[model samples]
Target: MTRRFLFAPLIAVALFAACRPSPEPGAGGITQVATIDALLAGAYDGTVTLAELRRFGDFGIGTFHALDGEMILLDGVFYKVRGDGSVGEPPQSETTPFASVTHFRADVREELPAGLDLPALEARIDRLLPQANRFCAFRVRGEFRHVRVRSVPAQSKPYRPLVAVTRNQPMFTLQGVRGTLVGFRSPSFVKGVNVPGYHLHFLADDRRSGGHVLEFTAATSTLEADTLHDFLTIRLPAPGAAFEKVDLTPDRSGELEEAEKNPAVRD
Candidate 1:
């Protein structure tokens, strides 16, 4: 796999000494399709084709190009969980701006406790992590007492920024349901490059509903995690006129953080 581990000069010696060799591609590692930086910079136009996405990994979460719908990769199938909360298969022509996937070979599996909301559930998972810096992908399956999610509608060209789009996102809450939560816990250093900490998306058992998970209370669920030691492979959109003209110099970390966790940034 293509690996990039250029540590800062101050910590290069110590960090390099502790780092392990990156594994070859397709070897139980996280294969992310695009960078969050592009999304934050408003590269909503489709870049990587769906056909190209499947070649990387199967279980992951992302949004369709133009933010048309939320994406859920479950059981090797890509489902477009749209703003109306309807789930359907997007065409092979559909594309994604950002996505992270892995073959999903769980190295750890355990039962989760009941009555835990998003923060509690995250804390529980945090305790189980082998290390803070290593990449980890999660797949939690089972019944949920309650779940709250949000999905944004497709935007026209000359699209508004994601923060504005999220402000108008449609939210849904379902009770007494079975589903799977697909997500990853990226290192804090990634910050603007990707969402640090847990970023999860949910898909129901009936495959009728799902979106970006805001909150959830699991009754009895199993949490499966794949610890990724392999380096990340990032793909950027084909630099076209629109991509080249758009200014990506500003840091949108604050807005992205609010949009992601609160779901009420506009309120």
Candidate 2:
């Protein structure tokens, strides 16, 4: 009875986002489904289907419905990194509650120096993209000494807040692997609407396993970044939608910071 009661609203939002007009395929700019604040507040139900999301862009990061796992959309395919550290391609019918993607035509290409971890890699890319205000989508492909990632298990009804869910989130460590890091860097102004800084997800070369990126030391990797001047956001457009009811007023920056960074690593 409790499960059915809680699921009613989630169903409403999904129906609305589905009926909303799909964006034209091959569109430019950053298209984000829903907002980060809502996700933090426990808006786990998906508001946008993968098939519709694919029309927006080919490269980006997001989470699955019910916060089932991490998402990596690379090269026109959607890959799921489950909490158990397994990777699999999700069907187009799957939905996403929060995602940010853009057409990935690299405007800058550079070879990253070996031994650069996530922070160092981000700093290097930041130097290349001096226009800090605009959004930048990037992909880094090549060898890595090791990469640490984490993913949350699927949630049931009466969902707890995101920070709470991630408290026991599972983490994985992969060594000497080759894969692509699909990610985005948003301006600080997008605080509640999107992750203000870098948000990335990883997928292995063999398509076996990967998850939300925590830390990594790259070895001779090549990077490509695309600068997007235009921004598009598709919220749950239905009137009186459940996602619309999620209270987003409180500042969840502290919770977000805690959930995103790996505790054991502070480099």
Candidate 3:
């Protein structure tokens, strides 16, 4: 079975790292398919085809229609990290309900230190890319000492909020794996529009396993930060009952925190 390799979460404390950067303020635009609020509200059906999404940018992160799997768009290729912890290249015909993409071009490059965990890495990078008000898309490639990631199962109709769906999300643990972490650092003002902090997805070099990266410690890696200085486009989903009828007025940052940061609340 494709789900054969799923593993329990592994706990490990991580350390801080340092970086050197020379920013190239602008190059590509950031195109997002739908707002994060919509996804958190259980509007899982997608309207934007990956084929069309390619027109906007090449590298980014998001999920598939029906919330089927985690998405990793690297070097113009779209890869799906399934709930089973297996990786596959989904067809361009498939649509994404929520996604963020950019024609990734490295503006600053740095070699990160060993044993740096997610928080530490984010902290280090934050210092280097101090433009907290601007969007930053990064690609971190290297060998990982340990990686913990998760992906929720495909949701059926009459969908529950994302927090509800991920309560029993499948978690995976990978050690001694080589991969690339793809994600973005959005401004705090983008809370409803996108993740306020960092939202990252990982894909192993073999492209055989990956998911929404929960935590990790890098053994060795290189960082590419693209400080986006171009325009930002937020595309609305096609008019449909799922998106149109859903209530998005409430503040769900608390909900989003649990959904994005917390691991499976239940087995």
lDDT of 2 by residue, 1-267 (tens): 999989999999989878987556445588888888889999888878999888888888999999999999899889999989888888999988888877888989999888999889788878999888988999999998999999999999898999999999999999999999998988999998898889888888999889988999998799999888776565463566459789889999988888888777634
Q: Judged by TM-score, which candidate is best?
A: 2
Give stretches of model 2 more than 4 Å off. 1-26, 265-267
Alpha carbon deviation, residue 242, candidate 1 (Å): 3.5
Q: What local lDDT score does residue 192 receive in model 1, on the 0 to 100 scale?
A: 66
For model 3 the TM-score comes to 0.87
Clashing pairs in 2: none
What is the per-residue lDDT of model 3 for residues 160-206, given as tens digits with 9 covering 90 to 100?
A: 89989888899999999999999899999998989999999999999
- The local distance difference test score of each candidate is 0.81, 0.87, 0.87
Root-mean-square deviation of each candidate, in angstroms? 7.0, 9.7, 15.7
Worst 10 residues of 2 by lDDT: 233-242
Comparing 1 and 3 on lDDT, the stronger one: 3
> In model 3, what lDDT does residue 200 have?
94
For candidate 2, give the lDDT: 0.87
